[model samples]
Every structure is written in C-alpha cells, then in structure tokens.
Target chain A: MALNVNVLREEFPILHQEVNNKPLIYLDSAASSQKPRAVMQAMDHYYETANANVHRGAHTLGDRATQSYEAVRDTVATFINAKSRQEIIWTKGTTEAMNLLASGLSQSWQAGDEVIVSRMEHHANIVPWQMAAERTGAIVKVLEINDKGELRMEQLDELISERTKVIAIGHVSNVLGTINPVKEIIAKAKAKGIVTIIDGAQAVPHFKVDVQDLDCDFYAFSSHKLFGPTGLGVLYGKQARLEALPPYQGGGEMIERVSFEGTTFNKLPYKFEAGTPAIAEVVGLGAAIKYLESQDRSAIEAHEQALLKRAEELAADIPGLRVIGEASNKVPVLSFVMDGLHPSDLGTLLDQQGIGIRTGHHCAMPLMEAFKVPGTARASFAFYNTLEEVEALFAGLAKIQRMFT
Target chain B: MSLPNLETFKNNPYGTETAIDDVLENFEFLDDWEERYSYIIDLGKSLPEFPESEKIEANYVHGCQSQVWLIHMQDPADGKIYLMIDSDAIIVKGLAAVVLCILNAKTASEITNTDVEAIFEQMDLIRHISPTRGNGLRSMIELVKSIASQQ
Candidate 1:
C-alpha cells in the first residue's frame, strides 16, 4: 500500500520509454493519466472474449457480453459509493455528460431562474449552464474567486438568491488544482433547496469520491482522466432526479416502446444512455477503479504533495518563475509562468528534454483572463510521478533559461 | 505581461513572399526535425516590435494557445494587404513568421487563392507542430482569411 514509484512505474508500460533521447517524464496527469496493464488488458480481453451488443443479445456471447457490461455498473457503483447501480448513467465523457445535464435541466428551469457557476470552472461547467439559461430564459451568475484562486466562499450567501434554481461547480479546479469546499457548498445549496451539480472530472482522478457523503444531486467525471479508456464517462444522479428529468438523447436503447404516436422511455440510467454504449471502455473503467482501490490513496496524496513541495522549493531558484494558484488545499497541479518566457515556449523547451507539461490557457480562457496572463505552463503530478521527474523538470527549465536569455 | 524590446526586427527579412521560398530552401537543407525546430525558433527571434498600445482585445485572436495579436495594412499602390503578427511565445511567433511569409503583401483574392496548407506540407510542419499548436495555427490562418475576405 505504500507509494512506490519504482514499483508502480513498471505497471505502466508507456512510462518506460525515451523521448528526444531522454527518459520520458510525464507530468500531464491533469489532462490524462497513463493506463496500467490491467486497464488495457481488461478492454482487450473483453473484445477477444465477450464482444456483442449488450442488453439485446440472447445468444452465448450476447448473454456473456451483457453480463460483463452490467457487472461494471456494479463496480462503478461501489467505486463512487452510489446508493444503487441504477444511478450511474454512461455517456461519451464529461463534456457529453455536461451537455446532457444542461439539456435535461433546461426543461425544468423557468425564465429568470438563477443558475450559479464559479469563476474557476472549466468551459465544461460554464458553457453548458449558459446555454441552458439561454434556452430556458434563466440567468447565469458567477461566484467569484480571491487572489489565491480559491473561490470566495464568504460570498455564497449573496450569490444564492431565492430564484437560484441550481448551483453547478467543479469539485476541483483543473487550472488552479484547488480542492473546493464542495461539501460545505452542497450543504448550503441543499438548505436553500437548490440543485447541486458537481464536476468531478478533476477530483475523481486524485481521490476517493463518495456521492452520499457530498450529498450532491449530480456528479460527473471522465474515465480517461482516471487512467481508463477514452470515450467513456459516468454520471451519478439521484434516482428521484433521474426519474423527473427528461431524457438527454432519444435512441434504440433509451426507449421502452417506440411508436409513431408517442414513445415510452426506459428506466433510470438507460433512459440517459441513448445508443450503443462504450462497453469496452466501461470494462476499462472498472479495471481502473479496481487498480486504484488496491493502493493506499492517502499515501498517493502524500507522494504527490511531496513532489509539489519540492517543485515549489525549486521555484525560488528561478529568478522570475511565478507560481500561480497558491491554493491552501490542492492536488498536485503546479501552474506557473516564467518572468520572460511564454508558456508555449517553456512547454516546447521542456518537451525537447523529454518532459511533457501542459501550457497555454488549458481550455480555461476566463481563468487566464483573470490571472492577467495568456496561459501558464503546468506540471501536474500523479502517484506514478517521482522526485527525479521533478528534478528533470527543473534541469530542463534551467537549460531553457540558458538558451532563451 | 509586457514583451521585451524586439527592435532587432526593424529590417525583418521574413516580411515578403520570397521569404517563404527561402524557408523552403532552408528546410530542404536541414537533415532532421531537431535542426528544423531550432531553425523555426530562430525565426521567432527576428519578430518585429508590435506596439504595446495595439495589444487590445479588438486585434486579439480568441482561440490560440498563446496570446496572438494581428495587425494589417492595405497598400493603395498595389492593393495588397500587409500583415504583422505577434505572440508571447517564441515558436508561435515563428509560426506567425511562417504565416506572414506566405500570405502577407498579397491581395485578398490572391490570399484566398493561395495554397497555405500546401506550403505547410512542403515544410513538413504538420508532423512537427503539436496538435494544440496546429489548432492555433489553423485558427490564425482562418482569422486572417476571414478578415481579408471581409475587405
């Protein structure tokens, strides 16, 4: 259970490689994590053994395929501690999930009803709400953030009015890596009888997420970020909420009975899952969760924190290396901009030394606007990341400085 | 984020169409991608000074990995539109140089008729630039073409 990068690194086949004649040092986990052998095999084995259209197949492989597919539903349910497997609806990923939620919520929201979003939200959380508001005649309000990039929790009362219909926010900021006060925020919103939607795309990758503990009405996350295959997402909704909301998409699997007159919709989760779902990806996600449960998450958190602290200490060495998002609580996301070097230039220079870090606005342009810069070069750590990788980043950065200046 | 003085680009060589041909020749001479990357970055060092005052939202391209500002002038004598691009990043600036060397000083119709992607292919830049940068490059070209077409 102890965090061992050397041992864990072997589990990831992609990690043991060279880039630009140097060992690959990947710190872009915030974007996507490298998959372990288990996840890849689970998906591959599913295709090789049980490959058929699920829920409709009646033959040998069909029944086996359906069983394997439904088994992952139970796996995800336990992974998030959902009340029942029926609450977990499959989508393409977080973006599709957001769009689905927005479209469904639009049918319920009335004109002039207020939808609250935060300043640090990724476009996934913000744009969908805006479109929902635009469609429903509801108004979108923003919760502000302070200097440290932490949401101003003090202003929550002022932001939430009687007309506030929903409070949609990110559980963890993708850019700042701030672990938001989501539990507290959910409680306050619940007290006011406001619907709470938490974007857990960033949170699910780093720590354990219990929907019951958070008491959120809806939670969304992507499997790819959790070291699983892409084109798969999980959206956990309260059973009652799922029943009340209209279906996001209408297709073969989502219908109970299709008629030219009127069609009856399917039950809770299937109603949201429109067409043929990502069966192999669902299997991969189950494997990713199983792999995660095998580790001591607390130790993973500690290892990541150690890496971040070491990077911060190294920041003092670079004369103008400005660290952004100094949130008191965070995962392992380190966003910063050098005094003279642009983020893309820094990212390119680092890439040459076989280090991969994300640069630019990172799909959060408003956050960049608020920070008064175009973008920041970010090196986000994961459990597999090591102290040596941190040192490599600094060495590459030092070389970049030498070349540029 | 103020940029350092780019006064060295006063007599910039990459401001004309012939510069594209020059780049094509130089790219042909390079043996590997690393040398080409270095060559492109060196092009960035020669960016002309874009005025601080012109760095406003009106001139800004919305969807770029780095901050990209574009300014242009239409010559009455030749009916050609001369463009200048600026970015905070070195490689992006180099990309801007690549763009300008092909499309700058051409009339709007001439710019539209120009095979920009073909030129990019000739340099084999499609394989070199990152996907995000490739998107940014496409966005810049689109912005340029859309604006030129409006005139």
Candidate 2:
C-alpha cells in the first residue's frame, strides 16, 4: 500500500500552524526534522514518571531511567544492524561522535599518515579530521567531486596509499542530496585495511542503513535529524574496532575504578559515554525508532521520491533557475540558484510567503567553493511533506522571480 | 586601492534627507509584508553605487548569511559620520539601507545615543535586526557605531 501522507502529517503537530498569516509550508527538514507526537510524548512520559540518572542510581526511578536509556542502545544497534549493542555509544550529536572517533583513532596516526575525506562532506566530517590532522601531523587528502555533485570514485585509487590510515566520508551530501556509494568505498577501504568512518547524519532519515552490511568501522548520526529529540546522537562502531581504540572521553560514568595512581576505563560503550547521558533524549530517540518501525518505510521512500520528481518537473519550467545537484541517486532535496538574485533574498521572500527554506552555504562552504556559487537556496523534504506543499513552494518561487525581474 | 570618495559619503541622503520618521510613516502606510518588503527592496535599489574596490576583506562584515561590506567616513568639516553599505541579498541590502538611514551623517555622540533597536521595533522590523537572523544588520550597526566613535 502507498504511504498515507495525510495521516503521517497528522502525527507532526507543528505542520498545522500558520506563520505570517499563511499556512506554514516547512521544507527545511534536512536542517532538522519535525518530531512526531509519539517521540515528544515518550520524552514527556519519561520526565513525568521516571526522571533519574542511568547506571549509578539505586532507586526505582533510576532503574527505570537506566533501563529506558540502555534499551535504546539495543534499538539503535538493531536499527542500523550492528553486530552488538555494545558497539552503540551515546554522543551529544554527530559532531561529537566524529570528534570522538577522530581524536581516538588519530592517537595511533603517525606523522605523514593520510586521512581521506570527500569534497562533498559536511563541515562536521571534514573539520574534525582536519583538526585531528593538525594535532598529529597527519595529512588530509581530498577525494574530489565532479560537477554533477557526485564523488569522483576514480580519484580514490590514486588518493589512497600505504600511509592512508583512515577514510572518512559522508553517506549522503547534506546540501546536494546525493546518496553516495559508501558501501563500495567502505569495501575498498576494508580491503586496504584502512579504518572507515561514515557520516550517516543525512542518510538515516531517508533510508535503511545496515552498518554490518556496509562493513564500516564507525557510523554516526544525530537524533534531531531522525525525528527524535535534540542533544542526543549515536556512534555505531564495529565491536573489534571500538574495543581496540582508546576511550574518547573520561568522566563519572565512563570509569571502571578511580584512584590516585591510575584509573581503568569501563567496558566497550561506557568508556566513550562520559557523565550522565541525554537520558530523556535517548528515550525520545527510542520512541522515534519504534514509530519508524511501525511505518511502511519503502512506501515512505516512494512518497518522498514522488515529491522530488514533481518538484524537479516544476523547477525546469522556471527560467534561469538551476538545480545544483544532478546525481542519479538522491533524497528529496532541491538546492538551486536563480539568476539575478541572491539566495538570502529568495529565502526572505519565501519566508514572507510562509515557506521555510535554508539559504547560504548550508555549512558546506568547500562544496559551495567547488560549485562556484555564493550559496544555493535549499528546499528539503520529509515524508509528511505533501505534493501541494511542493506546488506552493514553486508558486512562491515563481512569484519571487516575477518580483525580482 | 583608492581612498573612499568623501563627497559620495557626504552627499548620501540616508539620514539627512530620508529621516527614520519618514521611513516609519512609509512602513505604517504599507498594509502587508509583501508591500512592506517591496518598499524595502525599492529602498535597497536606491542605495548609492558602492565601489567594487572597497569590497575587500578589510571592509567585510562577518556573521552575515550574505556577503556585506561597510565603509564609513567622518566628514571633517561638519563633524558628522558618513556611511556606505552593500549586500548581495536584496533584503539584507534593504535592511542595511534602513540602518544607514538611522546612523549615517550623524555626530559621534548622536550615533552612539540613537536607539536603533527601539526604532526598528517601532517600524515592526525587529526580526531583521536580530543577530540570529544572520543578515548582518546588527553587525552593520555595530560597525557604524564603532566608526562614529573613532571619528
């Protein structure tokens, strides 16, 4: 059966509001998705009934909080098809997860070691590795992308060498919406014995990602982008790789025993998750995953693709408006630049029309530089977004173009 | 690069001819956001031609979603500050024009004392001046004030 978008839209209460006296047409889901009522209710329920710290609390509330928090690890592991729940380490967000992996893995990186990252990566993926390189004298190599906004896979062979210690790449481009061929890259990196880190922040919201099938060393995603509460993320590392690497942070919950002489770290996941975790956020994320599990995801994917198809069709009729990414495989994201107008100008006008879109570099400055555009106005879609909303966006754009001309 | 043309800054009529009161009255005349924004965009279109050479890194204002360049000169004779602002985004340019109308051709003390925020609130344009908006209107005001103080 087809996805019932009307029913799905009912689940997100924020979709029914009006902004600037017009019905709000939200198209900025790539930045952050609107949380479902179920996710919010789960979080509210946790705070109302069981509000306590996990792992160390002795009371019944503590036990409930601990159970709720720890169970999400299993959910996440199953969601991403990781081998074990021990591989799921809680993080503040994908940025923190990347920082953790970069700092921890770079500890073994020798001078002149190479860390490979694609040009299409978000700043979160690129900056962490760059910082790691700066600290350890490791060299950062770029795998370039073609004008089509797809990674130039041919360059990867020449970029990789014996000294290449790590390969970090985004599973999907946040700005371009290109679903990268990461599984192939991971396989190649695995054959070379190089550690692989995939920034799955954009990918998870759009499709199913089986970490074990991809054979990636580390995969990171933020809960906020996954229809869950903010301030929580997951870092799914291979069990062996995580066990071998040193702990990223040290604090209350992460320590096995503390003494003046030396402190031994806790087991697999706890060693990296320091202090009190985002307990409420974890519960929210678990609820979000459960909500997703209840849905027909393949149907959702089809609905999203149909929205994109209609958008692209309408976009082509508008003169001098160029869609930025033309990759064959992409999620429903439209990054475009209209001639004789700046992106922020478009953004402001669209906002007046009660449409929300993201303008500027979208935190992918290097990608902007590569495209030779100051920035592009992006309208990203989620499953709940109706075809009517897509039409409204185009109508708004047409009016804006007419005004500018 | 050549120094900024003092005559261009001195002759600009943002504050001197186009007062904030006049702008407020015009905004009140407009009924909806579309009319208001159209008026603002027109104001942006009326901004004096900014020199391309002046658009260097030194003149750039940070924290803007769009690129913004601001240059100021204090007219030695009148002891009033003169300003020039430019932005790639039309809305930002419009907001910058509004800022220029408030701050340009004012004495250092006068520029420092002007309640720009209150004026923006009165004009119902408080959102544009917000730092979170990332349009650089707030930063432009800061730059204008800093230049006025130095003068």
Candidate 3:
C-alpha cells in the first residue's frame, strides 16, 4: 500500500492557506496533525444527528450514540490490536493516561519499589512518575541516553532489577524521534516479572501498534497527534491488571452497584472512565482511525522516510547545523541547533515565512541537559507533509542564517 | 496596497485593520532599533479597553514574553464574554490587542473555533514575532480556552 500524497493533501482543509503572501508550509505534525475532512465530518455528523449522551439513556439517539461511542473502543482495540476492547480505556490524552497509571500503580507499589524511566520522556511521562515516586517513597531510576539520543540499553539493563516494579519509556521520543525498542524492553521487564508502560504518544500515530504483540503491560497515546480532536486518548491495559487495580475516579458511569455500605466498580473500561468522556473527541478519534486505515500506512512510513533522508542530506552540509539524536532507528523528527543562531531565533525567522515548526526544550528538559544546549528547533513530519515543504523549511532556514549573519 | 505593518496590530484599541498603510509605508523610514523600539512602544500606547482592575493573578498567562494579565467577563445581556487584557511589555500589549479582536465579544465556542492562523494571515501578525513570543501567544490563547471551557 503506497501513500497518495496529493489525494491525502486535499483532505486537510488548512493546508491551502497563505502565510506572509506565501503558501503555508506546516512541518509541526509531531505537536499535532491537521485533521482530514473525514474526521471533521464525523465529528460534525455526531453533533448534528447523534448528540445524545452515551451508556445511560433508554432513547433511540442514546442507543445510537452509545453504539457509536463504544464502536470507537473496538476501533481503538483493533487499532492497537489489544486482546480485548475491555483493555482500551479512554483518557484525556496520554498525559492523563500516564498519570492514571502513575497514581494507580503507586497504590500497590511499596516505598522501596523502584520505577525506571528514560531521560528522553516528555514531561508528561516523567513528572507524573516523579510525583508517584515521591508520594510512595519508591525509587525513581532514570536510564541515560547516549550523545546521539539513543537509550543506552546496557545502562538500562543495569538499572532494571528485582526491586524495579515498573519500567516506563516512550516508544518514539518526542524530541529526538529515537524509536525505542519497547518490545525488547517489555520482554526483558516481563522476564523479570516487572510491569512495563509504553508512552505511545509519539509512536502510535506514526506506526501500527499491536499491544498483544508487544506484550506491554500498558500502552498510551493521544488522539490529537493522530489527526483527531484533542482531549481524547486511550490507556490500554491488560484485563487482569485493569481488573485488579482500583478506580482512578469515583463517578457516575464507573460504578456498577453503589450502596451506603460499599461500591462495586463497573467492568474493565467503564470502571476507568469515571465521568462523562470527551464524547465528540472520541467520535472524531474514530473518524481519524478510519481515515488512517483507508490510507496505506506502509507508504506513509516510506514517504516520511524519504523526507527524513532528504532533510538529513540537506542539513548535513550546513557548517553550523548539527542534527541532534542521530540514532540508527528514528522517525521523521529533525532536532538541530546552528552555531550562530539560537534555535528560538531560527524558529522565529522560519515563522516569518509561515513555516510552522516547534522550538525549545520540547518538554524534555533532562534530555536538553544531556545535549548541553538550551534547546533545538524541531521539525516533525506526518503523511500529509510533502517534499516541497521540506525544501521551503530549509530555504527559510538559509534565509534566517543570512539575516542573522 | 502593501500588507498591514507590525504597528497596525500593535497600538490599536481593538484588532481592527486600520492605519495599515501608514505603518507599513513608514516601516523602513526608521533606521535603528531605538526608533523601532519607540515605534513599537507608541503602538502599545494605542491599546484599547483594558480593565485595569481585572489584572489579577487568576488571569496571568504562563510562558509569555511579558507578564500578561487577562480577565474575561460574561455579559448578561448577550452571553458573549468581554476579554480585557494588559501586558508588561509594550510590544506584548500591542500583541494582546491582536488577540483581543477575534477573541473578545465572542462566545466560548467562537473563541475555540476561530482559525488563529487565518487571523494571523489577514493581519500578517505571526510573520514578525520570535518563536518563543509566538508560543507565548499560543499559551495565552490556551489559557483563554481553559477558562472558557470551564465557563
């Protein structure tokens, strides 16, 4: 299956706008992808026709809404190839999803139990675990990355021991785009009877994910990065583990039998969903999943690979432009710093041309400390992005260099 | 006609597109950063309708180029929220005017649905700012939404 770039471009309405009298060149998909017409239409259709609340009503619209809402669970279940739809719990994106596990796992973990996380994790994955470790008196062990931004697997192995209760890592780094070996890491963790949680926020949108295949204890991702609406994501947990854990929130939907005496929680997914979920966003997420399935993902990956190669080739010759995270396995994220120009300054110049890219620490401060820079300019890619945009970005960077000089 | 100048969006009482030509025409007339700085400061002086009493801690924007205070009041007569903004930086104050135009006198949904990038194009606003300042603008908008979503 090959990606049809032109056809895919047509689906995203925002791609045609002009910026600074020039066509807008968007290269910040890592932050968030633009929604296609299908996703937009699905969200619109839901609001227009099926605006009723899900799972608590007896009316026809309610039934339809509930079915559509639950259909997304099945979609997510299949999307990640989870063992069952029961394992897919809707969250307020990956941040909340990771926090849920951090807080939830803290209940069972003892003070001396260790939790291992990578230095490359976004603040979302890191901070919650840090808080959890602080609250529970558990040890927080950080795995260091090499200069090229690849996680030192030998160092990682040395850190994970019997005392290590959980290993938290990102599948693909948000800043460096270093695709971590989560499957291998999970296998090792499982061998040691340790729980593993993978932050799939950066990975799930770019590649196909199969939770069962990876055998990870928990997997999380956000909908916004996958060309869907914000405020929606999934926390995929194995059924046994999910059933064993206590509910994160005490609310209307999650309770099955509530009495003055005691409360019995609902099943796997609803037990986790304590309040009214982001229904519209979830519907939009389903539309996004459908849109992605319609496309040829293998082709998307290949196109992105070609773009990454081109970006690397063009940037390699620049005297001061040193690409960060030169890992063997990486996605199409290019984080770089030039000698004379600050990354922030370069980003400002690039924006003058309406070239949208992200700069600063990318919410990975420790990783920035490791690199010994304030920050790097990051240009992330999605399937909708094109080679022309890449060229325009470089052209903008060149113009920026000349202006600064 | 040439596109709107940085000063046009800077000192306006509202974000209405006026004095675009005068600012753009005279943009290059100023030679150094000192004159440009004064020009930007003058632009800040033209900021409109800021309610000073509303500059409380509740409305302060995080991760901004300057300390910006924002207050949103829902008008009982028409369900629209009136946003009054102030910032420590003169340029930031002018930038706040740019944000207020589309955001002020609008419903919560309107603020959320507004195509900020489109507004930036119409005003040629985003092309001139630093990236951190741009992100700061985004952060201000996000803060607005966070408040609006609750309301």
Candidate 4:
C-alpha cells in the first residue's frame, strides 16, 4: 500500500505549525526529526504514571518504570537484531556512545596501532577516535571517499594493516546522504579481527538496520533521530565484544560490588550505563520503535526516494544549482550549492519562507573539504513530509535565486 | 594606532554618511522579509572591495555559520574609527554592513557606547543578529566594541 504521507503528517503536531507567516516545511530532519504525538504521549504517560528510578525501586511505580525501561532493551535488541538485551546500552546520544566505545576499546591500543575512519564521518565519529589515538599514541587513518561522494572501497584493503585496531565509519554520510557500503567494509574488518564500529545515527531513521547481518561489532544511534525523545541513544555491541572491554563509566547502576581497594563492574549493558539513565526517554524510545514497527517501512522508504527524485529533478531545472552528492544509493537528502549564492544566505532566505533547511559544514568538514565547497544547503526529508513540501522547497529556492541572482 | 590599507577603510561610507537612521528608514519602507532581505543584499553588494590579503586569521570573526572577516582601524588623522567587513554569505555581509553603518567613523567612546542590539531590535532584525544564528553579526559587533575599548 502507498504510504499516506498527509495522514502521517497529522501524527507529527510540529509539521502543522506555521513559521514566518507560512506553513512550516520541515526539511531538517537529518539534524533532528520532529517528534510524533505517540512518542510525546508515551513520555508524558511514563512520567505521569510510572515515574521512578529503575532496577532499585521496591514500590509498584519502580517495577513499572524498570519493566518499561528494561523492555526497551529487548525492543532495541530485536529492532537491530542484536544477540540479546545484554548488548543494548543506553547513552546520552550517539556522540557519547562513540566516546564510550572509543575510550573503552582504546585501553588496549599500543603505540603505532591504527584506527581507520572514513572521510565522510560526522565529527562525533571522528573526534572520539582522534582523542583515543591521542591517549594511546595510536594513529588515526583516513578511509578516503571519491569525488562522487562514495567511499573508495578499493582503498579499504590498502588502508587495513596488521596493526589496525579499529575501523570506525558511518553507515550513511550525514552530509552527502550516501548510504555507505558498511556491510562490505565490516566484513573485511571482521576478517582482519579488527573491531568495527558503525555510526548508524543517520541510517536507523530512514531504513531498517540489522546489526547481526552486517556483522558490525558495535552500532550506535540516537533516539531523537529515530522519532524518540532527546538525551537518549543506544549502543548495540556484540555481547562478547562488550564483555571484553572495560566498563565505560563507574556509577550506581554500572556497579556490581564496591570496596576500598577496587570495585567490580556490572555485566554487559549495565556495565556501560553508569548513572540513573533517562528512564522516561527509554520508555519513549520503546514507543518510537513500536511506532516504526506499526508503519510499512518499505513504503516509507519508497516515498522518501520519490521525494528525493522530485528534488533532484527540480534541482536539474534550476540554473546554477548543483547537487553536491550524486551517489547512486542515498536517502532522501538533497544537498546542493548554487553558483553565486552562499548556503547560509539560502538557508536564511528559506527560513523566512518557512522552509527549514540545514546550512553549513554539516559536522562533516572533511567531506565538505573533499567536495571543495564551503557548505551546502541541505533539505532532508522524512516519511511524514509530503511531495508538496518538496515542491515548495524548490519554489522557495527559485524565489531566493530570483531575489539574489 | 594604524592598520595597513588605511585609505581602504576611510573611503568606505557605512558609518560616516550611511547612518543607522538611514538604514532604519530604508528598512521601514520595505513591507516584507523578501523586500527587506533584497535591500540588505543590496547593502552587502555596496561594501567596498575588501583586500584579498586582509582575509586572514587575524581578521576572521569566529562563531558564524559563514566565514566572516572584519578589520577595523582608528584613523590617526581624524580621531575616528573606520571599519570594513566581509562575509561569504551575502546576508551576513549585509548584516556586517548594518553593523558598520552604526559603529563606524566614530570615536573610541562613541563606538563602544553604541547599542547595536537596540538598533537591530528597532529594525526587527533581532532574530538575525541573535547569537544562535551564528551569523557572526553578534561576534562582529562584540569585536568592534572590544576594538573600540582597546583604542
């Protein structure tokens, strides 16, 4: 069945609002998606009824909170096909998850050991590795991308060396919108015994992600991007891989036994989750996953592709407008730079017209540098966005070009 | 006390003749954001050609979405400050022009004394000038003010 995007739009209350005297056309979902009423209501319901600390409460509300919160672990494990709930770890967001993995994994790194990351990674993916390398005297290596914004898969063989400790890459390019061939990359890394970490922050939203099939040791994503609440993310690690590493944080939840000499850490997922976690956010994420499961994901994917196709077609007609990333496989993200207009100017003008698009380096400065443009105006579409909104974006761009050029 | 290309700074007419009041009046004539932004873009285009050499780290204004370069010189001859600004984004450059118009060609105390936020508020451009936009207009104004205070 064809996805009724107009009906889907009703689920997201934010989509109906007006900005700058015009109906809001939210195209910055890549930055952060607009939340649905279900997700919001779930969070509100959790706070109203089951608001209590998890794993410690003897009271009824405690059991309810713990049950709902722990249930999300099972939901997420199934969502990504993780081995068990033990592999699911709650985090502040993908950034913190990367930091956890990077810090925990880097403890074993020695001098001259290498960590390979793609040029297309968000700073969240890159910076943590750099900091890890700084601490361990490990060298951070680059997996270069071609001019077409696709990873040079051939270079991966050459880039992988005997001393390569970890291979961290994004499953999708946040800026270029290129859905990277991470499965292939992960296979090579697995063969070499190098731990593979996939940044799935941008990928999990647009499509289904099966971590086991991909064979990636670690997969990290934020709940906000997945139509859940903010300040919550998930790190799905292979049970063995997580158990081998030291605990990421030391706090009440992550503790097993405390003594003056040393403290033993909790097992698997709890070993990483130190503090009192975002209990409400965990419940909300469960609802988000349920919401996604309720939808026809394949249809949503097709609809998003149609939106991108329409955007590309319209972009072709606009004089001086050039789509930055033309990778054969991508999500519904249109990143473009005009001949004479700066992206910030385009972004500002688009905002005035009630079109919310992302402008600037998009936290992928290396990719931006490779593209040889300062930045690109990005209009990222979600499943709820209508075809008319796509048309309005091009219309707004045309109006902006007429005004400036 | 002096900056290179003093002649370049003195020739620009943003704060000297093109006062903030004139800009406010021109903005008042425009009805909508489209017209106002067009006028702002025009104002950006009117900026004197900034020397390519001066677009260096020393003059770069941080915290903007677009790359912005701002250089100011207090004229020893006239006892007044002269300012020049540029940005990769035309709207930001236009915003820089607005800042230059209000704060340029003034004495140290006068430049420091100007409430650029008030002027922006009056023009209904408070949103653009907000620190959140990261347009560097706020940083530019802060830089101008700091430069004036140091003088």
TM-score of each: 0.88, 0.99, 0.77, 0.98
Evaluate all candidate structures by whole-model CA lDDT and list the values in order.
Answer: 0.86, 0.91, 0.81, 0.91
Better of 2 and 3 by lDDT: 2
Candidate 1 chain B — worst ten consecutive residues by lDDT sum? Answer: B3-12
lDDT of 2 at B66: 89
DockQ of each: 0.47, 0.76, 0.05, 0.85
Look at candidate 1 and tell me the lDDT of residue A180.
99
TM-score of chain A of 2: 0.99
Q: Model 4 over residues A73-141: C-alpha lDDT tens digits? A: 999999999989999999999999999999999999998999999999999999999999999999999
* lDDT digits (tens) for residues A1-405 of candidate 1: 568889988989999999877899999999999999999999889999999999986698888888888999999999999999999999888888888988887887789999999989999998998988888899999898998999999999999999998899999999999999999999999999999999999999898899999999999999999999999999999999888899988888999998899999999889998889998899889899899888888998889889989988897788889888999999889999998788888887788788999987888878888899878999998889999999889988887777666
Query: For model 2, how does the per-residue alpha-carbon lDDT over A110-167 read when each residue is reduced to its tens digit?
Result: 8999999999889999999999999999999999999889999999999999999999
Q: B4-79, model 2: which lDDT tens digit per residue?
A: 7788887777887998788888899899888898888988988888999999999999854788998887777878
Better of 1 and 3 by lDDT: 1
Per-residue lDDT of A1-405 in model 3, one digit per residue for the tens?
666788889999999999656688898999998999988899899999998889978898898889889999999899899889999999999999988999898998888899999999999989998899999899989998998899899987789878999999999999999999889999999999998999999998788999999999999999999999998888999999898778898988999999999999998889999988889899999999999998888998899998999999989867789999899898999999898565655665576588989887888989989999877899998888898889888887776665544
Leading candidate by DockQ? 4
Candidate 1: where are CA atoms >4 Å away?
B1-11, B15-42, B51-63, B69-83, B98-135, B138-151
Q: Candidate 2, which segments miss by more than 4 Å at Cα?
A: none
What are the clashing pairs of model 3? B11-B43
Name the weakest run of 10 consecutive residues (lDDT summed) in model 4 chain A: A266-275
Ranking by TM-score: 2, 4, 1, 3
Please give the distance, in angstroms, between residue B33's alpha carbon in candidate 3 and its true position after superposition. 15
TM-score of chain B of 3: 0.63
